[model samples]
Target: MIVLALCLVDEARCWAAGESVRSVVDENALEGTPAALWDVDGAGDPTIQGFATDISINRGETVRFKVTTDASAFRVEIYRVGYYRGAGARKVADIGEAETFAVRQPECLKQAETGLVDCGNWQVSASWDVPARSRSGVYVARIIRSDTSGASHIMFVVRDDDGGSGILLQTSDTTWQAYNDYGGNSLYEGEPAGRAYKVSYNRPLIVRGSEYRRTSFWANEYPMIRWLEANGYDVSYLSGVDTARRGHLIRRHKLFVSSGHDEYWSGDQRDNVEAARDAGVNLAFFSGNSVFWKTRWEPSIDASGREYRTLVCYKETHAGEKIDPSPLATGTWRDPRFSPPNDSARPENALKGTIYVANCCRFDAVTVSADQAKARFWRNTGLDTLSRSQSVLVGLRTVGFEWDSDLDNGSRPAGLVRLSSTRLDVEAALRDFGSNYGSDTVTHNVTLFRHKSGSLVFAAGTTLWGWALDATHDDPDKQSAPTDLRLQQATVNLLADMSLFPASPNGALVVTQAPPDTVPPVASIRSPRTLEDHMFHLPVSVSGSATDQGGVPAGIEVSVDGGANWHPANGVSDWSYTFTPDRRSFVSILARAVDDSGNLQPVPTSVTIKVSGFARLIYAGLVGLVLGCGALLLAFVARRRRLLAKRRMMGL
Candidate 1:
């Protein structure tokens, strides 16, 4: 920031002096740049320094750390972040005084193939085998220099088990790497910005660029983790990459959570999530615009000779028309302009029940709907408080920067309940972009949907949710505004409800019984399929209620032409559709019900209505009567000649 400010100052001075510096600026501009340009953490003399031996370690594997300090003696302490009364970090190890060693900071340079500025290939000074007792979460190595005023830390993950019944905290490390301006070349820097197509974990994250000055973890991820842990919820931590790598890992876990700003994703990651949800894993997209990208990873050794260390995405304009063909296009999952031609588009809405529809609207108050107040989602939350709280969780500052909602696509899941929404006046700039985006008015909805597998997926639908939950990290810049108890209570109640489905003794996840889907649904035509001119009304409606054991059915569809075609029959309580007859004499329609469990009701109800319109109707009625009599006689004869008639009926 200082460099940018200073450079702007120079540009003004040059213009005032009538000097055209841009066209003639020499390489001196490069040599004269301050060394802070390459300083990983801006502390003039980095107080303490370190790197984890591995990104992830199995429960029994050895965990190592390479720590160093050029001159000062530092105290190295290790803390495990988990459910320790949610105090944030539990001190697990004190490696005491560690002798210092020098870490050679490599000069920043943009890679030709991948734009990341690679840094740090130093040697080790410490190593620790992951103790068998350590739980799953990010472990931070806090190195405090005895001679300095503050400390700096580096961390890694200890992935032990699938964390059944425990929440899986997915760290957005991929986004962190994208924004890591270490060595001056993150994907966020360079001319026109975002010029880098890829970034490497080989480099340290920039200080203060992201909230809490700790990449995506300290400000965004840690606060939520701390709150859950402090509240005594069993939470485990892993990166989104882990989800992509081990698609079925969440099978044993009841709920999976994504931290703030988790924008990037691999195609496999998207598949895994959808598969998990279908198999009964509850999901909480506690953030916004998730699973919008289709990406693939290839292994490559960093200069450190370290295997498995970089993030790659040939996204957006970066993925040109002539790129090689690969199943993973490394492009936007839903955008036609960015998705490769002839590729199947898998939009985020299919899994999330929503997607990033518009952006750049300032925060708006999040108001709950009356429907939400009456819905089962408010369980454990006091109704008096929820109703008397003015229906507003937070003011205009509660939602903004980005928003998501259930798009009006054909794939919105069945059995969804909307609880709240914020109406946003969009930025004209995005509107002028002239894409499907940039709507004049976009509403962000916070919703919950019960999957057929008997698990619920809740979407907070805003990027600002994490901010409200993170009061402990009082970093002024990251602090939530006009903070109140309602937002916190809502989250607390949500987690409490989620904890009900605990893991069984053998580590199997408990499945909830779908109350509204206990019994099969029954379908019926509430009104005549056809209307007579003398009828009380031209009734055209399909109606049904769930079977005896269940509540209202989730869906119903009506089919005409003996099931040749079908259309969704949506209604408030039961499926209903109204259609005025087009003067046809007779019409045949069938209705079927679908419970929350996606159980299609048997014995589809059918009805045929005869309209009283004359002339054309009489002629059609006469033709239908003749055909009906002929068909009945033919059926009887065919029944007598079974073998030949069966082949004909089978269309042989």
Candidate 2:
């Protein structure tokens, strides 16, 4: 078993003094508005809804908000979301009530052709000149009507582009806009073609009803913010737009976290994150259905023509009627069938170690077998105590709402480990989302893999992994899921392993010591073990088992041509490969393995057997044919002899 021991006090003490910027920011005892008062759900309609001019702005940069409401004036209350003494958010700045700060905005312009609601025509109702010393975080602008009749929220990020935080959390604002049908058009629906190929970011996001919180901030992101801040992780927040444009900021951090329903992603964003991961920055995908859609940025279709304000994704697979007209075809990232010129064939499984599989949301349990519970990440989580008969440990409501599965696509990362396997029957819930993967069953897997650069990538293949960490976050389905302490402790272990120690008081935790994995894994051929096993047919099948005591097996490679060319097998621990013999000669099969720590198998297990069945069958068929021809000739000769004897006897 992997060792999990107490971390050195000196090392812990060194980091103990290095408190995260978020921890320091939370130390300021600021007043916070209660959810009952701040949330617009109980107040009134969504008439006061609005959106920011930019998704994120640096300190000292001004972010403008355009509001269209029935109220004569509205208030823009800026609140930074964090664990501010359990208040969840602290009011940073409040601008409103006065004529200078709040004004009645003009009506939004809508495009009849594309069904796009362009609010860029509306006048700026409020502006916030962010302070130079303001902390970087996800800030919400609560637009409350002057009469207190209605209220709504506009979200933006305050970015500290220079500071180097331990963890950078990228909010799924792109997905929020995709599901936002504010002005009768979102990426998912609202057009003559059934959905808008292009979605503008200038309009309010999901301001229709309570469902706004469902896909927006509170859905899958807020819980992470609360839990990360509560644990005092040195975390910073940025929007997907920032990652696309100012991606150099990502390389500065030690860890990058893609959280929530982060489905839509630009090519630039994927490249930047992959570059960071390759550079040894640890990656944690606390998300599901991430990087599934391939989208691009465009200028707003308004008088100003501001850049990067529109998210364009044709969603060609879902529409199935027409492909994107642009050279840069917008569709699923994994699909290479884009209309020439440009295509994003990069499947998300390559980066995330898993890809989205399920179409509907179901609160399934993340079940880990007894063997997997022994991994260092699951140490002290009360899972290691599972009995042999009670082989699985379950985390309820951890897997939900469009989860992902492991794909054996050649792009899978080496040494990928599955921490949990939860299978679901999605026949009734199946909907084609570009990928024509029609299957009644899809297995949701929480995976971890070690990159060649020694950086670790962990994917909690479900969207609701955060729900088990914090129960107060808003759920779209309004399903009550209690907090699971085991999942929380596992998160702590994972974070600690990444070198970001918890600044807050967590229960007794163990950190695995760093050591070189020198021991290579052992591979054995389980099938076709002997000549008797290979005597059945010309086409042969080989199977094997591998064991890695130091770590999990990365992958298995099999060679059918006498170890000349090796190819990957489907699975690691238990693997199978099939090949047909080209000649009626002796054939050899060799199998080898490599561990996640880059330890290659010193010796490959080989099984050589003579494949003479084809040759024997051909020889026997030829012999039978010659014998039949001889018998026919003999019968003809006998008949001729009988006729000749009869003729001679008759004295003809």
TM-score for all models, in order of appearance? 0.69, 0.83
Q: How does model 2 fare in lDDT? A: 0.75
Tens-digit lDDT string for candidate 2 (189-208): 68847778778889887733
Ten-residue segment with the worst summed lDDT in candidate 2?
1-10
Off by over 4 Å in 1: 1-50, 66-73, 82-86, 96-100, 108-110, 162-165, 191-194, 210-215, 303-307, 317-327, 336-343, 380-397, 428-439, 468-470, 474-479, 482-652
Across 173-252, the per-residue lDDT of candidate 1 in tens digits comes to 77766666655555556522345656666654444444324335665566666555544455666667778886677877
TM-score of 1: 0.69
Among these predictions, the greatest lDDT belongs to 2
What TM-score does prediction 2 earn?
0.83
Instruction: Give the Cα lDDT of each candidate.
Output: 0.57, 0.75
Candidate 2 off by > 4 Å: 1-32, 42-44, 99-104, 207-213, 339-344, 387-390, 428-439, 508-520, 526-545, 552-652
